[model samples]
Structure formats: structure tokens, C-alpha cells
Target: MAAASQRKPATLQFFLSAFVVLWLIAAAFPFIWTLWGSFKVELDFFSISDWTNAITGERTQTTHGSPFTDAGYYGAWIQEEFWRNVLNTTLVCIFVVATSLTIGTLGGYALSRSGYKYVFWLLIIALIFRAMPPITLVSGYLPVFFDWNVWGFLPTAIIVLVAINQPFTLWMLHSFFEGIPKELDESAKVDGCTQFQAFRQVIIPVMWPGVVTTGLFSFLLAYNDFAVTSMVLAEQNRTMVPAIAAFLGTTYTEGNVMFAVAAVVSATAPLFILVMFFQRQIVSGLTAGAVKG
Candidate 1:
């Protein structure tokens, strides 16, 4: 009986280990392939004649005199002026995250602290807005922006992204603020601190985990956004996402698809680094609101 029971446990462990190994390979394979292919020539990478040439960099050696080349990165970044798009993406993300957090922190704090009945309805309305596709909202913004003569600029896109992001931000921060004790606010008041002071000095410090988590999400949305950024901003103001799309348009016909691949790998690098650095904060923030004071 003991031997049979031990065998059953080992069988389960073997299946679980196999499942994990398979899952990891499935998730990692595409990026790994792309990274490997990025160093090879387009012909080799997409070889119809011989796919093994991609792994071996057979043609890359013929052209660049090496098994690998940085030609794609150089072409995309230096020749194609993709660094400008990177700058735009960085600026847009910074502005969107900062503005969204500022407004969301204040508004969420107010909603969480107030006992007003309308606050419930207000949150429901915000939820509805959050649920609506951002692309739908873009058409409405276009006419207004055209009339205001604010279309096709960085600030306009930043403002639009900030507005689109707000409802979710408010929802997240509201829940996070709710997890904080009301007694802290009361104590601040007892010490003659204003409501803003209580929030700025007291709640903000304790709410760092939730805020960091929310900000990461905001940064991601702004960074990864394509539809809104593309439509709102002009050619000169294009962000990384739109620029990659543009690369697809011109590079493929010019036999430079490897440039687009390299751009993708480059774009992915920041997000990878971000996750590696802030993964701990992200986990903490995600769980912070789960517990109540």
C-alpha cells in the first residue's frame, strides 16, 4: 500500500513538471526565434529554400562578412530616424502616466473618502467609460481637436491618452484608497492637517505599492498604444508603435523586413527590463487592495 501511494505521487509530479516545461517552451519560442532571426539577413530569416540558413546565418556572412550583423538595428535607428519615435514614445508615456496618476489620486481619494450616495453612481459611470473601446472615443475627439486647432501634435495625443486612461486609473486608485484606513485621515485632521495634506503626506506614502502598480499599467497603455497615437499625431510626432507599423509598410517592399524585426526586438527590450525591475512592486501593488484596513 505504501509503495503504491508513493508511485501515485511521483506520477503526478512528473505530469506537472512536463506541463510546466511545455508551457515555458510555448511562451519563449517566438521571442527566441525572433531574436535569433534578427541577426540574420531577411532572405535567410524567411528562407523558403532552406530554413536552417536562418539559424546558421548563411547569407548574413555573404553580405556582412560575418555570421551575424547589426545592420537592421543600424538601419532602423540611424538611417530611418526611429530614435525620434522612441523619444516621442518615452515623452508620451511619461506625460500620460504622470497626468493620469495626479488626477486619479485626487479624484480616487475624494471618492473613497466621501460617503455620498452619488459617488456609487459616479463610479458606475466611470466603469462604463472604461469599458467603452478607446477607438470609439477617438472620432469624437477628432472633430473637437480640429475645431480647436490642436490636432496632430504630441500634447494633443498625450491629453487624449490621459483622458482615456483616467477612468481605469480612478477605478484602481479608488479601490486602493478604500483599503487604507479612514482613521489616518481623521488623525491628520486632528493634527490640523487639511484633507489634501492628509492625502499628500499620509495616504500617499502608504499607498506607494498601489500607485506604483497603477502607474506601470498606465505606462504600458501609453507605450503600447497604436491606434490612438497614430491617428492623433502627425508623421513627425510618431511614437514607436506607429513607427513600427510604418516600417512594415516601407521596409517589406524594400526587402528590409529584418529592420522591422530588429525594431520589434528593440521595442520589446524596454518592457522586458521594466518587468524585471518592477516585478516585485507590481506583485505587491496587485495584492495591496485585496486586504482591507
Candidate 2:
């Protein structure tokens, strides 16, 4: 009986292991394929003749002598000035994350401490705003932006992204603040610390994990946004994602599809690095409020 039971469990474990392996391959294959193809020429990468040409770099070998070439990267980064877009994206992310966290921390702390019934309704309204698509806001801003002549600038895009990120930031930070003990702030107040002082000294240090996680999301929003950035930004002031889109439009027709592919791989590298380093903080922040005492 014991032997039979063990056999069934072992069989189940084997199937589960196989399923996990397949799932990981499915998830990782696209990035692996893109990275591989980025090193090859368009003909071999696209490979209409034989799919193995994509793997073997057969046509790429003919053109470049070696199987791999950095021509795509050279075209995008050096010839096309893709680094300007990278700088724009970095600046936007910094401004948006900083601005969002500043406003969100204050507002969330206030909401968590206040016992008013309106606070509940305010949170509900925030949820509603968060649910709305960002594109919907563009129409409303177009007239104002055009009239003000600030439509395609970095500051304009940064403000819009910060506004979009605020609702979610408020909600997340409020929950994190709530998880922290009220006594910490109260004790500081009792010792003659002003509300702001208590918040700065007592609460702020403890909230870093949650703040870091929320800031990561804010950074991602500004970094990855294509629709709003594309619509608001002009040709000279475009961010990386929109620049990549523009590359796709012109490069494919110019027989430079690999430039777009290279741009994509370049764009993805920072995010991968961000996740690798801060993954622990992300998990900690997510679970900070799960089982509050």
C-alpha cells in the first residue's frame, strides 16, 4: 500500500516538474530569440527560405563574413542618435517617480491617519480614476497643451505621467502606512515632535520598502509609456519607447528592421537590471500589509 501511494505521488511530481520547465521555456524563448536575431542580418533573421537560417545566421555570414554583426546597434545608436531618446526617457522617469512619491507619501499618510468617512469615498474615487485608460486623458489635454504651446515637451509629458501614477501610488502607500503601527507616530508626537517632524523622522524610515516598490512602478510607467509619450512628445523630444516605434515605421521600409530590433533589446536591458537588483524590495513591499498585527 505504501509503495503504491509513493509511486503515484512521484509520478505527479515528475509531471509538475515537466510542466514548470515547459512554462519557463515558453516565457524566456522570446527574449532569447530576439537577442539571437539582433546579432544577425534581416534576411537570415526573418528566414523565409529556411527557419534554420535564423539559428545558423546563413545569410548574415554572406554579408558580414562573420555570423554576427553590430550593424543594427550602430545604425540605431550611432547613426540614428537613439541615445538622445534614452536620455529623455531617463529624465522623464526620474521626474515622474520623484514627483509622484512626494505627493503620494503626504496624501497617503494623511488619509491613513484621518478617521473621516470622506477618506473612504476619496479612496473609492481614486480607484475609479486609476481604472480609467490613460488615452482618455489625452483628448482633454490636447486643447490646453496646444494653446499653451507646451504639448511636446519633457515637462508636459512628465506631469501627465505623474498625474496618472498618483492614484495608484496613493492607494499603495496608504495601505503601507496603515500597516505601520500608529503608536510610532503617536509616540513621536507625545515627545514634542510636530506632525511633519514625526513623519520625517519616525515613519519615513520604516516606509522605505513600500516607497521603493511604489517608486519602481512609477519609474516603469514613465519608462514604458508609448501612447501618451507618442502623442505628447514631438520628433526631437521623443522617449525611447516612442523612438523605437518611429524606428519601426521607417526602418522596416529602409531594410533596417534590425535597427528597430536592436533598439528594443537596448530598451529592455535597464528594466531587466532594475528587476534583478530590486526584486527583493518588490516582494517585501507587496506582502508588507498582508498579515498585519
Candidate 3:
């Protein structure tokens, strides 16, 4: 009877593992297919004649003398100046993440430690702001930006992104701060440290994982934003997402779809690397926030 029970559990475990593997494959197949197609000419990648052409790269071989070619990348990055858009995106992300985290860390810490009843109301207000769609907020900012002649600028976009991202950071970091014991702060105060010194030297070190997790989230917001960036940024100041959209073109103009495909691959590769590098911290940070000591 014990052997039969063990056999049942073993079978269940095998099935569970198989299910996870299948799910991962299903989730990954689209990006994997797109990555493969990024290296081929449009005709081969999007072949209506034979769907197998995407896999075999028959036309790609004829056109480029190889099954793979870098022409799309060259066209997007060099000829069309996608590098400039990449640089703009980098600057926007840096500024947005930095600004959001700075404000969030400070504000969250204060609110978490405060003795005031008003803290609840303030957090509720922040939550309301955060819950609203970002696009709704963007429309309000447009008139002011145009009036200030600050429209279509990197700083303008950065400022807007920071505003959109700040409330989330504040909420996340506040929860993290709450997870930390107040005893640590008292211990630092007894050790001749000021409040700021305690926060900077002791509390922040412990809060590092939470900060990293929050920062990563803030980075993603600014990195992946399409609506705000597209509307606020001029053509010359466009970021990767908007630039990639431009590569797709509209009814009025022709677009290089392969360039967009190649650019998509280029844009997505870094995010995977970042998550891999920070995976441990992310998991631990989330775990810490969810569980109270």
C-alpha cells in the first residue's frame, strides 16, 4: 500500500513537471519564432507561398547568399538611425527610474514610519492616482506642455514618466519599509546615529533588495511605455517603441516591416538579460515584502 501511494505521487510529480515544460514552450514559441524571422528577408519570413520558408529561409538564401543576413539590422540601426532612438530610450529610462526611486524611497520611508493618521488618506490618494490609466493623465499634460513649449522633448517625457511611475514606487517601497522592524531604527539612534544616518547606513542596506525590485519595475514602466512616448515625443526625439511603430508605417507611407522585426528583437534582448541578472534579488525582494517577520 505504501509503495502504491509513492507511485501515485511520483506520477503526479512527473505530470506537473511536464505541464510546466509545455507551458514554457508555448509562451516562448512566439518570441523564438520572431527571433528566427528577424534574421531573414521579409519575403522568406512572411512567405505566403510556403509557411516552411520561414523555417528553411529559402528566399533568404537566394537574396543574401546565406540563410541569415544582417541587412534588416543595418537598415534599422544605421540607415534609419534607430541608434538615436535607442539612446533616447536609454536616457529616458535612466532619468525616470532614478527620479522615481529617489522620491519613492524617501516618501515611502517617511509614510511608513509616520505616527500621523493622515498617512492613510495620503496613501489612498496615491492609490487612486496610480489606478487611473496613464493615457488619461497624458491628455491633461499636453496643453501645459504645448503652452510651456516643452512638448516633444526628452526631459518632458522623463518628467511625465516619473509622475506616472512614482505612486507605484511609493506604494511598493512603503510596504518594504513596513516589513523592516522599527527596532532597527531605535538601535541605530542609540548607537549615536541620526535618523538620516540610520536610514542611509543601516536601513537602506537591508532595504536593498526591495529597492532593486522597485527600481526594476520603474525601469520597465519607462522602458515599455508607448502611448505617452509616442504622443509627447517628436519624430527626432522618438524612443525605441515609437520608432519601431514608425518602421511599421501607416496607410500614408511605406514601412520596412523586417526592420521593425529586427528592432523588436534588439529591444527585447536586453530585458531578458536584465531579469536574469536580477532574478535572485527580485524573488527575494518579493518574498520579503509578502511575508512579515
Candidate 4:
């Protein structure tokens, strides 16, 4: 009886595992297919025999076509549109990440250590900003930039993105700073370090995980942002997503493999780079060495 019961549960577990695996594959296919299809040229792409369509269930044949052109993998990262978007993305992310990380960390540390009456008021203000009034907020900045002839383009769009992300980063970093024990700072003080030295020598190193987390969020905010970027931004300075939107000028190929390829690679690149660089801190930092701390 015991053996039969155990076998029944094992059977259930096996089926459940198989279902989960298949579910994951289904969910991931669009993303994987987009990346693969991005490299394919036009002809090889729509052919029912193309492997590009084969795995994606768009077509049911395994008939091999030219490996890359059919697979939509070659021209993706090489194209002018893709590179343009990449440059725009790089500029925006640099501003967002740099400002958010620096300000968030400093503000977080201050909030953590201080009981100043003004700090209480600032925290409230930060919370309101994080609510993200995209339309209203953009409206506020539009006239100012427009008056200065800075609206709808390069430098101004970048600044608007930084403003959009600032509050969330500050909030995330503040919580991280609060989680750190104050005792460490006190111990550093007893050892003759000043506040700045203690933060530099002791707190900052320990809070690296949190810093990375905050930075990742900041990076993603700028990277994935579309609505505000689209609205606040004008014709010429479109980022990768909007830049791709430009190609949607009533062309059939716009819906074909090349466009998908560009979309996937361009959009995912910064996110991939950030995750690659901060893989350790992001994984470890959410909890931030809490066990040992």
C-alpha cells in the first residue's frame, strides 16, 4: 500500500514537472523567436519551409533554408536603425543610471541616519514623485523645454527620463540604507572614522547589493520607458522603440523578420548588459547579506 501511494505521487510530480517545462517553453517562444527571426532576411522568413517559422509554429516544415537568412539572425545588430536606437538608449541610460544611483544612495543614507524635520518632508515629496504622473508631469516640463527650444529632442528628452526615474530609485535605496544596522556606523566612529569615512569604508561596501538593485531598476526605467518618452519626445530624437516606430511607415517588411529582429536585440541589449554586470549584486543584494549582517 505504501509503495503504491509513493508511486502515485511520483507520477503526479513527473507530470507536473513536464507541464511546467512546456509552459515555460511556450512563454519564452515569442522572445526566442523574435531574436531568431530578427536575423532572417525577407524571403527565407515567410517561406513555409523556413526553420524560422518551423519552431515558432508559423509553419510546420523543417525544410532547411540558408541557415541565417532563414533564421533571421544576421542583419539584426548590424543595421543603421538598430545602431541609432542603441546610441539613443545608451545616452538615456547613462543619464538615468548615473543620476539615480548617486542621488538615491545619498538621499537613502541621509534618510536612514537622520531625524531632521526637513527629511520627513522630503520623504513625503519623494513618495509623491514615485507615483508617476506621466502625462501631467510631462505637460509641466513641455512648456519649459518648448520655450527654451529644447523640447521634443535630444538633451531635453534625456533630462525628462532622468526626472521620471529619480523618485523610485531614491525610495529603493532608502529602504536598503535603513536595513543596514546603525551599530556598524557607531563602531566605525569609535574607531576614529568620520561619517563620510565610515560610509565609504564600511557601509557602502556592505550595501553594494542594494546599490546594484537600485541601479538595475533605474536602468530598466530608462530602458523600457516608452509612453513618456514617446509623448515628451518629438520627431527627431526617437529612441530605439520609437525609432522602430518610424519604420512602421506602411511597409510589409515592417511586420516581417527583420523588424522583429531589430526590436528584440535593441530592446534587450541594455537590460542584458545590466543583468550581466550586476548579476551577482542583484541576486545577492535584495537580501543584502542579511544572514551574515
Candidate 5:
């Protein structure tokens, strides 16, 4: 056996560490402020003691800003609206991921397999629509949705989200399908399988990493979205991010603190879980089409 020699970095490590620390500090302040501000009343924001708006018009609470610091932390975050927002965000994320992945996977497979001028145009149009700002799409589509009786509020949001997500996921998994050898499809057809069966039984299992990766992107895209949802959803129907924004209103109360804590809990939990769950497949999918195997 050969003895292993250790490699050492010179001055780069210290500078890199300092850079990361500064960046982290910069990032941490806003969340910390939000968290801390949640605890104290709106009047207590500036003064050492709690007072009504009449005593001190200084409304913004200092404690509400702190992400890491709170009086009761997660224990105090249980409120009706908080839980409702959590449920709303979760449902939207799941639906968006599932719908986008299914539609994208099937469409991607078709696009990759067939050669048609219309498909090219469609792809280009979808890409263009996706490239445009989400607000633009929301603004253009809102009046249409408003006029229609069947598609108001949440349904409208879902339709718009699915439209946005389809292009990105289709593009991702289309490249994955292209990377696969055509012989597999032919071989499956030569056996007892049809085209749809080959896709379901053969292609899907083989390229699952790509599918999973697409799902991950869709999940996060829907989960963290605020702007489009804000435009489409009313205040009562607000999702997680919008709910967090609602916390910073003129009247800061216990509900605001609860909302902040709920924000931290819900924000981190599912996101971390999904990443950890699909960690292996996501890594492979990200690198899959980069090089020939």
C-alpha cells in the first residue's frame, strides 16, 4: 500500500471563509429581523416597554425581524390562518409538481421522438411565454380568468402555474429522452410492447432521474413563488410567501409573530425533505446530459 500525502491550501482558505461569513451575515439579518419583530407588539417595536399606538406611533417592531430569536418560537405559531396558508402552499406544490412532470414527460417524449414543424413552433412559443415575466402572464390572463365563472381565484392560479412549469420541465426531460438510444424504443416495440407501453415500462424507469429532477424544480418553483400568486390569489387565499408578506402590515400583533414562526417552520421543513429524499437522483439527473456515458 502507498502512503497518502495530504494536500494543503495556502492563504485562499482564510479569504474564502471570511467571504462566506460576510455573505451569511448579510443574508441572516433580514430573516432575523422578521423573526424577532414577530414577538413584540407594534408599539413595543421602538420603546423598551409595550404601549398602544396612541402612546407611541412607532409601529414596526424590532423583535419581528429576528429569524433565529423569538419568545415562544414554533410553539407560539399555531393559528388558524397560519395552518391554512401551510395547507394551501402544500396542496399547490404537490399539484404543480405532479401535473407539470406528467405533462412535461409525455410531451417531451413525443417531441423527442417525432419530427414536425408545428412542434418546433410550439416549443419556441412555450419557451417565449416562459421567458416573459410571470407578472406579465398574470396580468394578461387575470381578466380572462375573472370573466370566466368556472376559473376564478385558486383554479386560475393553478392553470397559470401549470402553464409556466410545463416549458421548463419539458425542456429538461426532452434532453434526457434525446440522450437515450432509439434502439431501446425499437426493441421494446419489436417485443410485446406498444409505443405508450415502451415509454411507461422501459423509458420511464431508465430516465427516472431526469423525471425526479424535473419534479424537484417544479416543487421549488411553485413553493417559493410569491409574485404570481400575489397577483392571482386574494388575501384570504394567500399562499405561504404572500402570508409572510402579510405579516408586515400596519397592525403588528401576536398573530404576526405566530405567522413568522410558522413561516420558518413550513419554509424549511418540506424543502429540506424533498432535497434529501431525491438527493441521489437529482445529482445524476443534473449531470446526465452533460457528457456521453
Candidate 6:
């Protein structure tokens, strides 16, 4: 009986492990396929005659004299000057993340510690603004931008992105602040630390994980933003997402689809690396409120 029971559990465990493996493969297959195809010519990657050409790279080998080629990357990065868009994106994300975190940390800490009734109302107002679609917000800003002649600039997009992303950061950091015990503040005070000093020294050190989590989220918002960047920035000031869209071509313009494919891979690779590097902090930040500290 004991032997039979052990065999049943072993079989179940094997099946569960297999299921998980299959699920991971299924989830990862599209990205893996895209990554592979990024190195091949469009003919092989999007072959209608033989789907196997994608895997075999037959057409790619014929064209490039090798199974893999850097033509797509070169075309996108060098020929199309996608690097400029990437630089623009980097600037937007940096400014957005820095500005959002600075304001969010201070505002969140204040709201979390304040014993006033208006704090609730303030958060509610922020939530309302956050819930609105970004496009709608952009439309309202457009006329003003045109009047001010600030319509198509990196700073304009950064300002809008900061506005759009601020509420979520405030809410997230506020929750993180709430999770921290009040005793820390009191202890700091006992040690002759002023409120600002306590916040800068004692609270912020403990709040580091939550801050990182919020900053990463803010970075993603600014990084991936298309609607606002597309509308607010001029052709030369376009960011990566809008530039990738341009590579897709519209009715009036011819696009290099392969260039877009390569750009997609380039843009996505960094996100995976960032998440992996900060995985621990993300987890801690998310779970900070679950058990009071």
C-alpha cells in the first residue's frame, strides 16, 4: 500500500512538472521566435511558401550568405537613425522617473503621516485623474501647447508623462509608507532629528525597496508611452515606441517592417534585464504592506 501511494505521488509530481515546462515554453515561444526571426531576412521570417524557412533560414542564407544577418539591426539603428529615438526615450524615462519619484516620495510620506480628513479627498481626486484615458488628457493639452509653441518637444512629453504617471506613484508610495511603523518616526525625533532629516535618513532608507518598485513602474509608463509621445513630440523628437510605429508605415509612406522587428527586439531586451535585476526589490515592495514592519 505504501509503495503504491508513493508511486502515485511521483507520477503526479512528474505530470505537474511537465505541465509547468510546457506552459513556460508556450508563453516564451513567441518572443523566442521573434528573437530568432530578428536575425533573418523578411522573406524567410515571413515566408508564405514554406513556414519551415523561418527555422531553416534557407532564404536568409541565400541572401546574406549566412543563416543569420545583422542587416535588420543596421537598417533600423544606423540607416533609419533609430538610435536618436532611443536616446529621446532614455531622456523621457529619466526625467519622468526622477520627477515622479521626487514628488511622489514627498507627497506620499506627507499623506501617509497626516491625520487630516482632507487626505482621503486628495487621494480620491488623484485616483480620478489617473483613471482617465491618456489620450483624452493629451487632447486638452494640445491647444495650450500650440499656443505656447511648446507642442513638439521632449520636455513637453516628459511633463505630460509625469502628470499621467504621478498618481499611481503617489498611491503606491503612500501604501508603502503606511506599511512602515510610526515608531521609527518617533525614535528619530527622540534622537533630535527634524522631520525632513528623519524622512531623508531614517524613513527613506527603509523605504528603498518600495521606492525602487515605484520608480520601475514609472519608468515603464514613460518608456512604453505611445499616445502622448506621438501627439506631443515632433517627427525629429519622436521616441522609440512612436518610431517603431513609423517603421510599420502608414498609407502614405512605405515602411521597413524588418527594421521595426529589430527595433522591437532591441526595445524589449532591456526590460527583461531590468526586471531580472530588480526582481527581489519588486517582490519586497509589493509585499511590504502584507505584514507590518
Candidate 2 per-residue C-alpha lDDT over 166-238 given as tens digits, one digit per residue, 9 for 90 to 100: 9989988998898799999999999999999999999988988788888988888889898799999999999
How does model 4 score by TM-score? Answer: 0.75
Distance (Å) between predicted and true CA of 83, model 5? 0.3
- TM-score ranking, best first: 2, 1, 3, 6, 4, 5
What's every prediction's RMSD, in angstroms? 3.2, 3.0, 3.0, 5.4, 6.6, 3.5
lDDT of 6 by residue, 162-204 (tens): 9899888988898889889988987998999999988988898
Which model scores highest in TM-score?
2
Estimate TM-scores for all models. 0.93, 0.93, 0.90, 0.75, 0.73, 0.90
Listed per model in order, the count of residue pairs whose N, CA or C atoms clash below 3 Å is 0, 0, 0, 7, 17, 0
Candidate 4 — which residues are off by over 4 angstroms?
A: 1-8, 43-65, 70-80, 116-125, 187-194, 250-257, 273-293
Ranking by lDDT: 2, 1, 6, 3, 5, 4
**Candidate 3 segments whose C-alpha is farther than 4 A from its true place:** 1-15, 190-193, 250-255, 283-293
What lDDT is obtained when candidate 1 is compared to the true structure? 0.90
- Clashes by residue pair, model 1: none
Candidate number achieving the greatest lDDT relative to the actual structure: 2
Local error of candidate 5 at residue 2 (angstroms): 17
For each candidate, the alpha-carbon lDDT, in order, equals 0.90, 0.91, 0.88, 0.69, 0.70, 0.89
Structure candidate 4, residue pairs in collision: 38-72, 38-261, 39-72, 39-73, 39-74, 40-72, 40-73
In model 6, which runs have C-alpha deviations exceeding 4 angstroms? 1-15, 190-192, 250-255, 283-293
Q: Can you tell me which runs of candidate 1 are displaced by over 4 Å?
A: 1-8, 283-293
